[model samples]
Target: MLVLEGVSRRFGAKSAVEGVELSIERGSFIGVIGRSGAGKSTLLRMINRLIDPTSGRIALDDVDVSALRGKELREWRARCAMIFQQFNLVGRLDVLTNVLMGRLNKVPTHRSLMRLWSDEDIAIALTALEQFDMGSFAAQRADQLSGGQQQRVAIARALVQEPEIILADEPIASLDPRNTKLVMDSLSRINRDYGITVFCNLHSLDLARAYCGRLIGMSQGRVVFDGGPFDLTEDVARQLYGLEAGDVIDMPEEMPAAVVAAQAATPPVLAAH
Candidate 1:
């Protein structure tokens, strides 16, 4: 389980997050939703230790995640992997090599610097790429792939880390509608198949409603609502997004049958826990 107690962060006079308290169980698929500047990204960054909180505590099971430093902090980051809006991949490197970078924390620094990836590690990377249906692009340069494909490579890299939690910050914000569906479906599959806790920061209400089992609504650097999809009524949504009923927009149309058929046709590629 991951617990946050009175967690808050501030930038000079500006507060990013304030007095947030949450108890997230393992294997849960949660979507953090809000308007821009609602502190959604800051919250995820704090959990991943990419940023420190100004006050309060963050704990994963028995460990005090907020106090970790140096090597311990690096290990924590490895365990709680992060995916971003921009797919962070080396442009010049082949897809396989980019995926292998996830194993850096597991290998000696010198070995990583020398790019000495073992057959076993290569196999692991390959398996991850296969899981995302990017196995055929292993030898291709990351920059050469389309946005959706590059994001899949980024996900494959995250999978190779064998993380306990995935903190995705606006992962699909830059993708087209079809690519958005593909990325979201891939994330959903990873959460379902691997039992990894997923905390996705999403701007699209429809996407959150479609994929997440639970929704956390934030407003002005504070958690305003926490409940399931059905529990988030129109009034509650208005309060969260500060929008009138007519202004609320529906997300792109979903082709459920086609998505299901595609998923069914793909060969199942299981990750090693």
Candidate 2:
């Protein structure tokens, strides 16, 4: 389990996150929802140790991850992988090489610097790409792919890391509706099949309701609601988004034909899972 106790972060006088307390179980899919500047990204970054907390503790399985430094910090980051709103891939590198970058923490510095990937590592990277239906594009440069394809490639890279936890900070924010569904489905599959815990930050209440087992609502850097999706009442949502009483949240029903075709083309390796 990952536990956060009184965790807080201050940027000078401004508090990005404040006194967050929660316990996340293994293999759970959680979505953090709020309006802009609600500190969802800051909270995820604190968990990954990309940003340190000004007070309180973060722990995974009884280990004090918040205090870890040097090699321990690097290892913790590898164990807890992060996916961003932007698909952070090297434009010049081939898809295969980009995925192979996940193994850097496990391999020797000299080997990684020289790009001396072993056959075993290559196999793992290939398997991940195949799962995401990107195996055919292994030789293609990352920038040449469409937004959806690039995001899938980024996911494959994360998969190769073999992480216990995936911190996705608005992963589908930039994609179209079709790609959004695909990305969410892929993350869901990973959580269900591989037992990897996923913590996703999202703006769309409907998407969060569809994909997450648990919903955590944040407002002004503090968690005001944490429960199952069904427990998120309209009143609470109003408070979370700072909306008026009668204002309705837009819930669009869309499943593009392209999404169906893409799913059909996804390899059986992932479909079975």
TM-score of 1: 0.90
Off by over 4 Å in 1: 244-273
Model 1 vs truth, CA RMSD: 7.5
lDDT of predicted model 1: 0.86
Top-lDDT structure, candidate number? 1
Candidate 2: misplaced stretches above 4 Å?
Answer: 244-273
| Candidate 2 lDDT score at position 105 | 91
Question: Which residue pairs come into collision in candidate 2?
Answer: none
Clashes of each: 0, 0
Question: Distance from true position, residue 47, model 1, in Å?
Answer: 0.5
